[model samples]
Target: MEYMNIINQIIILFLIIIVGFIAGKNKIISQEANVTLSKILLNITLPFLIISAFNFDFSKNMLKTAVTILIISIFVHGTLSIVSLILYKKQEEGVRKVLRFITIFSNCGFIGYPVAGSIYGSEGIFYAAIYNVGFNIFVWTIGILIFQSGNVKGKGLLRKVFINPGIISVSIGMTLFVFSIKLPYVISETIKLIGNITIPLSMIIVGVSLCGTSLKSAFKEGVYYYASFFRLVLVPLVVYFILTLFKFKGIYLGIPLIVSAMPAAANTVTFAQIYNGDVSCATKITIVSTIFSAITLPLMVLLLK
Candidate 1:
């Protein structure tokens, strides 16, 4: 029954993503405008969401569980990230999306947290939050450096990572979590209001980002095959089997699979913009992979049981 509710919640989230895309398609919100919206969500809304999640005093019992989940979730997202990068290198260079895609995108933060939390409780959210922040930092610093080789301004990249609003918010959340401090109500609610906009806004931005692309190309250049197989099929399949071997179950396994399967990180586009790499190719990858996830994610979870 609890799992059913989670499933329903996830379906609703998917509907929201689609609705955002439709909204963009109809010009209810121009895709061009979403770039700024994305910035607002990342820099302002998301971080507050993180802090706002800490509204209650994290009791000692909840703290222990949170700590354990955080540590384990890191291992889950981090390990797969390394493996994905290696596999990414083996693929053709034209598909540069694979390179940036794996390192940066993990649905756990964006999709996984909300989906899993609605189902498994804060334990799911705790793990999902860690993967999103930790994965983002890794990609921004090490991952960006690797993919940034030919393009992007290499100088002061680390500086960019340090000041990233999302990154800064994670640092803030961790501080509050450790000291067990509750933020003031007014500020917390404000953050909550803004933060809640993340998923809906992100989905819409994704639709807007797809504005000028050719959907027909989804099957072109073998991009579709690689994007679908690597992200949806191959990566998660391997992760799924390996996780089962380790006997990790529930949100632990659930979070990684979802994260691993997320469409190429939106950050891929951000990195391309900053680094001047194959932005068009990266954008295409994001669009394609995200569309694929809508189909693949539900199927993957069905296989989980």
Candidate 2:
């Protein structure tokens, strides 16, 4: 039953991506329009989603679980960051940088929360919300730093890491959670309505991005396959088995498993473009890994059984 549910969820998400792909291919949405959509997603809708996820009735136990998940999240991402850095140490500058960034980050916000919430309800997104705290921190800091061929900008590093939209959302969400404060019904409902746009919009952006890429290149590169395999299969499997050994059951166990199984984040390409890394390689990595994750994610859920 759990397996079927996961399959259903992935199928639904894939269908949505196809919608975006078709829209992109047919020129229903122009590149400018797509960029605007991406901005709306990251800046507006995603923050609302974060806030709404924390809008539920609060409790001591919930707080504790959130903290526990945050700790585990840090551990998971930190471990992977080290592993990727070590493994990619000998590669060329550009490829090595892109590989490291994609390897450490996953689509935890766009894909992770939706799949997790599907299986585990709001509780899942609640945990996923906290899991993203670590994600936002590292992605903005270490993730960006990895791709920069030039000298590190130490001036605003602290500001950059702590002041992003992701971290800001997490902070507001945590404040709401910690204070047991609830927004007015009208306001909260409005936030929820906007927040609901996040998943589809994010997936559409991904699909649109994919429409311009050469799937052939994504497959032709042997390195792409190795990186995708490490990302979509091996890393998640390692996280799962290790967590199981410690007997961390329930959402504590499941959240990490779901997150670890997510594909390379769509922003790998975005960050690469911004930081002037290997944008083509980043796009290839993002697209190919996402395509493969549809298969690996379900298998990972089955293994959880």
Q: Which prediction has the highest TM-score against the true structure? A: 2
Residues 85-132 of candidate 1 have per-residue lDDT tens digits of 555555556355445454445545556656665555545555566656
Q: 93-189, model 2: which lDDT tens digit per residue?
A: 8888898888899999878878887778767887898898888878877887787644567767778878888888889988988888888899999
Give me the runs in candidate 2 sitting further than 4 Å from their true place. Answer: none
Worst lDDT 10-window in candidate 2? 147-156
Estimate TM-scores for all models.
0.84, 0.95
Task: Please count the clashing residue pairs in each candidate, in the order shown.
Answer: 2, 0
What overall lDDT goes with each candidate model? 0.65, 0.84
